[model samples]
Target: MIAALYWSMNIPGQVAMREGLEAQVKIINEQAQQTNARGIKLIPRIAGDGAEGIEKQIQQMYEMVALRPDAIVIQPTDNAALAKPLRAANRAKIPVIAYDQYIDDGELAAYISSDNFQAGVMGGEYVAAHFDNQKPIRLILVEYPHVSSTVERVNGFLDALSGNQQKYQILKTYEAVEPISGQRAGERILADFPQKDSVDVVFTVNDGGGLNVVEALAKAGRNEIFVATIDGDPKSVENIRKNRLTRIDSAQFCGPLGAEAIKAAYNVLRDQPTPRYALIPTFPITRETLSLYPGWAGPIPQDFKKPWSSLEPMWRGQSRVVIP
Candidate 1:
């Protein structure tokens, strides 16, 4: 049996990521009942949310190493903290496949994740194009710095904005990735900027808590605020369609990512030459591009020969798989 270690399931994007992993197990279990082929069993472990959760995850990684599973698939919490266990796994000749997040130390058989940085660039491009004439665009960022994925996204967004020469000043930054903290951010934004047009844009790292911020602002009638967020949560995309505060949401191809991780592990076990790293493209859902997006559970839409923007946030007609 192989072991699968997942980060906090409380986050929507992580939940979507896990769906792909679970789907693999479901298919294998069903196939085992009908055929004579031996079934692959997966041992799943979950971490709690918050600071203590980080400790739990680290401890779990150490324990997983001791179990000596054939392979270990994980969405790591703190990259440096988990290195010891990962290195131990390496010594044991146990292959490790990571998704959603990556660890700096230890050898991973494969790493699969969304193009997080590109997703940020997509958000920045939309902001630059949407407010072309709006100079010195006042911005507020909602970010969580603990994870590499979110940090890469913010860096990509800033880089794109800089490339466009769109002059903008960051007004304030807030931290939150779930409901309670997001509500606090929403309330703080209201308090920080009471007047309309005081703030031009807010970019949230994901929809997990980002949605709550939208609701808080919407309820308070803060219609002028344009929000850009990552993660393809159905609610976030719907908000764009309804013309709400959320303007653009760059969504991850979560199901395929999860399935890919399992496939990568399988390939390693079979001694097949597997790519060390892979990234699934993200679909940026704006009001104009919403029609092209299939919900998280649906199939990935075919590439659009003519995309909505010249920047081209997604792969379009190319393979959904990208190695970068």
Candidate 2:
């Protein structure tokens, strides 16, 4: 019987991560069905957006690792804080695959994720080029913590703005990951940094948070500012199409990468060769290509149909999708 442990942060709040996890779970289960192996059992977990919440989640992961499953797949709540669990898994000789978040501890079997730094650079450069030499550029920054991608994206954005900071000063940075909460945070920040007829741009690390900022700006009748974000979920892509958001980088293939990580784990177990890291490209999504996505591409709640334990046989090549 083959088993796996998969951890994902609170899906109810972060749509992009939630959707990515759900899609991977779906593919993993389907693959298991074909393999006729004991299904890939996933131990589900989530961490919210605060220090206390993250601490609790890390403790839970440590406890779960004691069960000693075949592999542990995770989008860690905090890569730095979760080192203890990875170390434990390493001692137990258990293979671990981290998705979306990279663990530099060198204990994991492999890491899979999008190139968020490049996405951020593109976003920053796009905005900088668009608003060249602008005056009184009031900027609002919406940020989230814990996730490595979030931190990297912000870093890349700032890096691109190097030597071009005077024309665009950040007025305020808001916090919150959930769209509604993010919107409220944006509103509060807006009230404090109200355009003053000089605000020119708004930036968010992820699309869900960006949407909240856009909603707050719309309600306040502040449409003159350029908004940019990472993750081209349907809504954000739509915003770009409608001209509400200035740019969108769709690091949208995370789900597929997660699914592949499981396959990589299986290959490792079977003594087959596989890459230590899988890099998924993040391309910009504009109004011209927004229609290509499914209607549920945005911040929709995850509704996974099956559990990981029931999907084992599919991975052995039975009940699998046949490619042309």
Candidate 3:
């Protein structure tokens, strides 16, 4: 049997990201079965929310290394600490594959992630399109550190506005501990923003953050500011459906990514050399394209109904843990 370890930076429990990773795990297992290859088994490890100091995460990485699974597919907590585990895996002859997040290491093979930079550009373009022209636009950006995906996204967004800085002025940048903290930060930002309608746009790194910004703006009795974000979570999909705001998602394809990583590990097991990276291109998702896009929306099965439960904050403006 080909054994692999999977770790996500989304803490021990958060239904949305957890469900996505679980779905990815399921798909990888099924793909392994269909191929008649020794199925890849995933051993899951949690790394908190990437905010509660790095010591625990570092310890977890070492534990995962000690177990020495056939391979490890990881979304790193701290990009720097990732190198130690990955190097240990390498020394032990276990392949490492990364998805959604990248760690700086030369020996590791393969990364399957959406083009985060392009997604950011799409967000900027969406906001620009709303204005019909690039005018003096004031905006707020909420982001986090160590998640290369998020950083790449911000780079892409800024690149999209190259030579267009005059058109968009970033009023402030707030760093959140996690996506849930983003909501609280959004609420605080609302109070600080000028009462005048000067702020025209809000760009967040993910749907969780964007939705928080939306909630805060709504609470402040403010609308009309174009909100854009990454991550095609169900709430973002519902917002698109209702035309609440425009979103440029990276079409979070967790299954395909995990499956590809598993396939690569199988190749490694077979003593075959594989490529160093798998660049999954970004797929833009707007309201008109939601139906064609599958698996990006949350709350899983379409047969279920909860009357806005899909869009309602699963985190409920506060962060907590719910393990499965």
Candidate 4:
């Protein structure tokens, strides 16, 4: 058996997560070798950056399908853009698994990803609790609108804040797709609101952008602004521990997510029943609880308490397998 794993981009944090996925694939192959079962070949390709990168991704998918790999797993660069090529794979009778980011419209054997919406909800809940009875929250949201996962996170964050409109006033929104873009966005925000206490809180979809925001604020000596973000990147985790700026980061259990994705692919290839969608868990890590966090590329903290415990029952019901 053979499978092609197509990654959207080769960013630092994503690279760390990809390593975990690759490790699991190796383990699966090793087990097959020992048991004399059919071993799987894992092929990897990374889409570079921006529009050109998306085009490359589409072309790669078309090429992979032509090669007739048994299965293909992809983290699409864009939600809707990759539909055509993915549909082509469907027509080829090749199983396609959507990993990390989802294809908004396509025939997918399985969809594996973190509970991104819940991650944002965790961020929002943390922010609300921090400012429970305090003055109105002057919030600025930095988001990447291109990807479905980030969009869902932003929507979930907004949903959590909807109940307290009076308490949390949305000041503005900026699109920061990556770290450099986020830095530029941060500079713009600082230029617009020159005062030290201009914005009370900032919510960035990912830690890459959030770190840039932190840098921009720190450079301007605006340590007063509170930040909430997703992606428990090592740098972000360190910042959370050292600097008082970052409040909470909803960590995705990427290692478990990758292992589950491979398992789903294996099941699909074997003509076994697999859930259409599998959502890996996410938990919030704060400065106070940093000691318990097991890092972003995670073996989930055994003793750590899940921030979204109430939603666990529903999550367990939806997920095909329970993750530790």
Which number leads on TM-score?
1
Between candidates 1 and 3, name the one with more favorable TM-score. Answer: 1
Candidate 2 CA-lDDT value: 0.62
Question: Which parts of model 1 have CA positions greater than 4 angstroms off?
Answer: 29-37, 305-309, 313-324
Evaluated at residue 70, the lDDT of candidate 4 is 91
Clashing pairs in 1: 303-316
- The order of the candidates by TM-score, greatest first, is 1, 4, 3, 2
Give the least accurate 10-residue stretch of model 2, judged by summed lDDT.
311-320
Please give the lDDT score at residue 322 for candidate 4. Answer: 27
Q: After superposing candidate 4, which stretches have Cα over 4 Å from the reference?
A: 1-5, 8-10, 132-134, 164-166, 302-324
State, as a TM-score between 0 and 1, how close model 4 is to the true structure.
0.90
Per-residue accuracy of model 3 over 114-208 as CA lDDT, tens digit each:
66776676666555555634466787887876678889888877666652333777898887535577778777777788485867777778765
Q: Tens digits of per-residue lDDT for model 2 on 303-323?
A: 232111111111110111111
The order of the candidates by lDDT, greatest first, is 1, 4, 2, 3
* Candidate 1 positional error at 172, Å: 1.2
Query: Which residue pairs clash within candidate 4?
Result: none
TM-scores of the candidates in the order shown: 0.92, 0.77, 0.78, 0.90
